[model samples]
Target: MQSPAAPATPATPATPATPAGNAGGIDPIVALPARALSQEIHARRLSSREVMTAYLDHIARVNPAVNAIVALRERDELLKEADACDAALAQGRPAGWLHGMPQAPKDLAATRGIRTTLGSPIFRDNVPAADAIVVGRARAAGAVLIGKTNTPEFGLGSHTFNPVYGATRNPYDTSRSAGGSSGGAAAALATRMLPVADGSDFGGSLRNPAGFCNVYGMRPSAGRVPYGPGPELFLPQLGCEGPMARTVADLALLLATQSGADPRAPQALPGDPELAALTPASVEAALAADLKGKRVAWLGDWNGYLPMEAGILALCEDALKAFPAFGVDVEAITPPFSPERLWQIWLTHRHFLVGHNLLPHYRNPTRRALLKPEAIWEIEGALKLSATDLHAASVERSAWYQALLGVFARFDYIAVPTAQVFPFDVNETWPKQIAGRAMDTYHRWMEVVCPWTLSGCPVISLPVGFGAQGLPMGMQLIGRPRGDLAVLRLARAYEQERDWVGQHPPRALL
Candidate 1:
């Protein structure tokens, strides 16, 4: 992949700047939520050119240390797009939802004319001639393409590190991980380098990194946001692409643009009519989602069956207490399921799918050496499974889903910690252990996230507060299957009282 160009001086603006406050070299416009910024741009309170310039300056100044944005488009071309946006607005043409915002697609997603390495040396210079469905949606919504963020090699493990561009460090602490495979997206959001970001999740790629970086990430209900295509179309509840941002409302805006009917994806849902019709006003209005009289179940560590690091349970418990204050009845509850069985099922399906899709690369003489150890382990594990084993695992997954549905029958929402542990050292590919228990595999440390993924339910990771070590801790909110709108509403209500989403990492880390 091409290295990001040296920060270029922003082009002269075609329209004047907005009246927002500017202090400490930070553009006050950058602090505004994406929804609000879109309004400002439309109202002529801010120009698309000015907004894009501010973000470019911010990215140039802050991205080097964390290395979240591994590749970039020339500043001049991005500014030109922004200028065209302003010109259209000047002519009184209606703008799309994200008009003029700067965004970088996750490396795993294809982008036309831009290098999408998927963090692998083998495809280091590969560029697609077309945009992934999600990227097309964002561009149609008026987002100016900046570049692609970093990810793990083939997104094999939760951690985001690859030989192509190296690891993406947490913005909170340069020495620690940002979490993956959405690590770059989360870190970019935390540092205010981009207004909003896009990511995909399977086994906590979206939620874990958002937790680690103190941002908000949503794993929309299966089929709510459709993935375009990949090596294989069918798998055991494979990954879903979703939105990430500093605020739930911003996330809502991005989601609205990305969620829609796609004939190519047979699993795609006919999304919420309201969400499909979402506007800036609608997104802003969702912030007032009523929490009164709602029933919430707080499942902390699956009743202590799931291993977690020190302070995580207590931190999550304290975070859930706010639900009561929001007028929701909150109680500790255990969903019926064996954590061990669920983990085994998840591994069986995940390994089988990944292995089936990627094994050919391993066998190829040209690409064999490019395979990472974690990828090899997963593919080999898949080799040991029989057809009967896959069917049995599918049956177990169904049982797990039914058990979660039983819990949902008793509560409107279930809350849990987003990760088993907080951010670990960036240099380490995966945690050796958590809470004194030796992790049996590179992915076992993130088993807390697999249950929700396995259930195919809507999940959101919200920044609650910090840990004893000052790294961010996030709590997960799981909605019943296909309850994407409801889950987002609950998150919006909670975000109203918490300032965690608005908090930024220490400036020193940048």
Candidate 2:
């Protein structure tokens, strides 16, 4: 791979002035969110064409080294989109929430007329005739689709490399990873290849990569964002499409634009509370309210399936202490279910879904060769699951839910480390030996993320602060089921108090 150009020098915490390199020329717009950029365009400070050209130019310059963007649309098409936005502005029309913003979609999500490779050689030239639900929503909100980002094959792993697109390197340290299958999205946002990007999370796909890239990511409550065009769409309710951005407000804006009830997903509505109104101020107010008398629990490590890296636990514990500052009584608590059993259930369910859904492709040796072994393992595990096994897992899952209910009855929220370790090397797969124990499966190393997945609770991964490595470490704020606003409110409060927003990857120096 070619070496990436050195990033520009680090700027101060305040939004840096548009670079002097951009003088009368469209230099790449780095680190700004879609909403903010759109506001600038509405104010006539920048033209949509200039923003598009800046991002397109940046992609051309850096995408070769990072391999983040898998496809770039014709400049004409992007220009057309820009012209539409400009015409709207000319008519004195108010722009939509994301009007005139250029964004990239994770390659796994279908994009109309654009190659959506799913990071596999099998679909190297595949293009969907229709947009995925989220993509359609983004477009309707007036987001200009600049390109598709990279992902692992079938989004089966946490690392983004595949036969179709090469590995996406971390912008912070080229030698480290940008985390996957949203690695490409994270890298692009970190390097300012695009103002903001979209990502989907099955198991930390959004949160993990955001933590790795030092951006903000939220995994909304399942059914909060509709995902579809599949027979068993509701089966894997744990997964959902989510937004990734450089600031808490940007993420909230994207969520507002994309979230709502779909007839296809009857349960995905935003409830009585308005999600769009969530801001750092509201979150701080909620954090300040009733914490003095509220109960809080912290899970330092989950049943030892994966060992906590030395500083990770300390970092999380320190963040948890802030709950007390908000007036909540805090204590370390353990859930009722076994971590191993949770992993087994996740593997069985995920494998079964992938195996049956993708049977035709797996039957072909050529296609199967491109499938990740972990994906194959999931399929095999699913095939072996009996009705009894599934029912038993469901029972255990219910018991785990009950355990959470018990905890919530005593405490308002549960806090845990988002990942056992900070960002690892970009070239390696997940750590094989987490705490000296041989991790038997890809899901084992990510045990903490799954417990909340099974419980179907709304969780937000908030950047607590940088770890000893100078890489960001996040704390998972698991709120009551359907407590999306409350969780986001808490995240906002933490973000305000700590002011960790706008922290950029060192590579942005280039």
Candidate 3:
């Protein structure tokens, strides 16, 4: 934990003059949570076109500074989406959960008639003829497509810089990074460029940027949200797409619209829960405030393999202590497996996937140059791995999963700092070190985030507190496998108890 920086005087951005005495109007539409706008639309207090126009206007205003959005549909096309929503209203018909909302998807997700560059020059002019499953569902539910958000080249790195669209700066501070490969999506949400955005996480793509930008992000359990339009479409046990928003409620709203089992998935199960039904009020009502009667554990420092920032541990400690105030009996608990072994297993699995799927692109000088060196390195490393090594790693991964059963026996939830340190210089590839210990790998410091990724557990990063430099910090709440609602319930209660939603960045342009 780094020492807290001295608190500075709160600075406000020069308030833009309100048009036509509309004091409440003209504020960034992107800032309003999705649920708020949906309610406004359902009540007919605001037209869908008005919401779409406000966001389009904001994108015009801020895209230069952040480079968050990639492609905007023609104005007529956007108006058509809004017109359809208005027509439904005229017919006395109810729109779906996200009826008439505006949103931006990561460029990695295919969008029909919209160019999805994937942050590479090769696909700069490429446009898919059909929407990916998730995008189609959102559009059918009445979510107007605002544009495409940026990503790292092929979404291979943690930072959101690429040749096609360039870099997306942190909304809080221009010089700092917004975090990546979901960096642009997080940046858009933080600055209210969109009320809600879509993001995918194979590693810490979703959570990292959320923590970096002080927003709520969830990486749902594997198969919770279907992913496709990629080379490997059937493997639901690995990566998935989820939602990001300014608040948990908005994230839930978007998740509900996009989540379900696709017929294409062989392992797909029936009855994906509707996310819209999980409201903040309903979730809070379900969560027990006091953990005193419940068992809770904190995997502090993960057996001391990774170094944490100075105050990070303290902030987490304070948050954990407060859980007992909510009646959770808090105690320290250890996993049955070693952290080193788990890291090895994770590396093995990740390398094989990347190597087999992505290595050939690295062989082409043109394609190789378009990708980040880190991505190439990962592929090359994976290519060299032997079958014996992969088999051993698989065995270890299973053993680790079984080890988690013991922890589940005594505790209902596990807590850890979302990232080892708070947001750092956005220009760097990854944090070089933490608390003086050398961070040798690009993803080493993110070890706390990997356990849940590997185990396919439902995890949510809640804005717990702030640390040095006035930047926000979050603690991850890890739930038992398939306990998505339970984790969200606890997060909703904390949000109500803490009321951290109103904390916004300074208005001054840096």
Computed on alpha carbons, the lDDT of every model, listed in order, comes to 0.82, 0.72, 0.73
Q: Which stretches of candidate 3 lie over 4 Å from their true place?
A: 1-30, 273-292, 506-510
Q: Return model 3's CA RMSD, one decimal.
A: 4.9
Off by over 4 Å in 1: 1-25, 508-510
TM-score of each: 0.93, 0.88, 0.89
Worst 10 residues of 1 by lDDT: 11-20
Ranking by lDDT: 1, 3, 2
> What tens-digit string does per-residue lDDT give for candidate 3 at 384-404?
899999889878878877878
lDDT winner between 1 and 3, please give it.
Answer: 1
Clashes of each: 0, 13, 18
What digit string (tens of lDDT, one per residue) describes model 2 on residues 28-80? 35445565676678787887887888777777877777777778889999999
On lDDT, the candidate that comes out on top is: 1
The candidate scoring highest on TM-score is 1
lDDT of 1: 0.82
RMSD of each: 8.8, 6.9, 4.9
Candidate 2: regions farther than 4 A off? 1-29, 270-273, 276-295, 303-305, 323-329
